[model samples]
Target: MTSFARKVANLLGVAEDRLERLAGGDLSEVLLLRRPDGRCTVAKGGAGIGTEAAMLRSLAGAGAPVPMVEGEHDGVLLLEHVENDELFSPLAWADIGAALRRLHERRGETYGWPVDHRLGTVELDNRQRSDWPGFWAEQRLVATASILDRPWRERVEAVARRMAELVPPDPPPAFLHGDLWSGNILVAGGKLAALIDPACYYGHGEVDLAMLTLFGSPPPEFWEAYGPLEPGWEERRPIYQLFPALVHLRLFGAGYAAMVERLLDQSSRNLSTTE
Candidate 1:
């Protein structure tokens, strides 16, 4: 394989004096390239990363804080490296909230993206659907159920069947950063730097917030700037969390299955409360 850094340099028409690989997760390898002029850019290489450049471009156009895509060749995606300027601050989280609000404002006619992308190594379904609940149930909940053990899989499928009733209807289809965990959130110099490694789609906006709150809680400033979430948002979050928990189960192993089971149980209880 032609090295990712070399491919990126050729595509960007630069002569790199230094190329250092950065620590990325299992799906992609990231390289930091410095040209003789001291300009730095990142090169991401993976088997199926070609669509990510287009996603970055689209998000940038919609005012989301994302890296500017420099170019691409083969599986190497060249993006303008954001220089880390500051640590995370209240103002930074607030800025992220506002920027994300702007991003969600840029909506589509249907729920999904133009192309499919990966949430880790697993395929994320972006096939458009007119109905949001059906999209979530089919694409997110049931589609991910296949990786579960037979009993858990059956239970999850039952939850999917109840999705129409479980989730409220007629919320506007909002753009989503399909995988929006805090790890994908970058901060520099106490300011929001970029949202990286997206699996873009159009769905319920709460999906992003659910993932953000999965590992840790977002600061109060973030919620203040983002505006109040939908009524009963706290209850709906576990249902949204199921997608990523299931993603973890598929990618990591059965250890994550317990988390998925807990979320399923919570969903079941919440469903009863609603009923």
Candidate 2:
């Protein structure tokens, strides 16, 4: 067993009789821990592991479906093991929609997290900003400048400068699960089971919704149950999507760069129409 698995087992007051190292998609160690009694839990260890623990606590406290943190140590967190029973059904998606809406209702005073964190190994700046558009533009888009090609960088900067005009900025800030993609969404028993790996912050709730639709559109049931979206959300989705696309472009390179380009082009065209 890896030292990480043993450390978590010890922290949780269990023997490491059954420890299975699982596939952690990012820069972390993941393990399934089972005690002699057959009870199971998950252990994660790595940089920023504690940040996720804090997010799970906050999200669970706000009524979002998340695993209970069983124990935590330096860069290691033990979480309640939620068994996956089945994929999401329309009814399950409705539950997810309701849960996310409740989570968003937990508002914050500003548009950033209290501490800096990572979005899949990329350093994310959490410096608070009262203005949402400027916050998104600087923290999310323009932040990618150092990694991008000159042409792409210039285009992105141009859009960032015009972000306030292209995207509506009047929505009140709310709790956001900063990285709410399909992978972070867990389903069991044909229902939404848990939300994991949040890069939590205070922003428009639509930021989470936009990430959900980035790789693929959510089931229509999600929309039906999510209720009416914020005004101008449709017009702003492509712009919100640019944040993750830029993150991916920076992480994985040109394949995702194409996605960033497409989103920026769409946002630019939309800006033209508005003008």
> What is residue 232's positional error in candidate 1, in angstroms?
0.4
Could you tell me the lDDT of residue 248 within candidate 2?
A: 86
Q: How many backbone clashes does candidate 2 have?
A: 1
TM-score of each: 0.92, 0.91
Residue-by-residue lDDT tens digits, candidate 2, 1-275: 66876787677776776677766556577888776677888888778877888888988888888988987777777788887655767887888888888888898888998888986668888899898889888988888565678998898898888988976675778899888987788888767889888899999889999999998887888888788886778889999998888888877777886788789889999889878
TM-score of 1: 0.92
Question: What is the number of residue pairs that collide in model 1?
Answer: 5
lDDT of 2: 0.83
lDDT of 1 at 42: 86
Alpha-carbon RMSD of each model: 2.3, 2.2
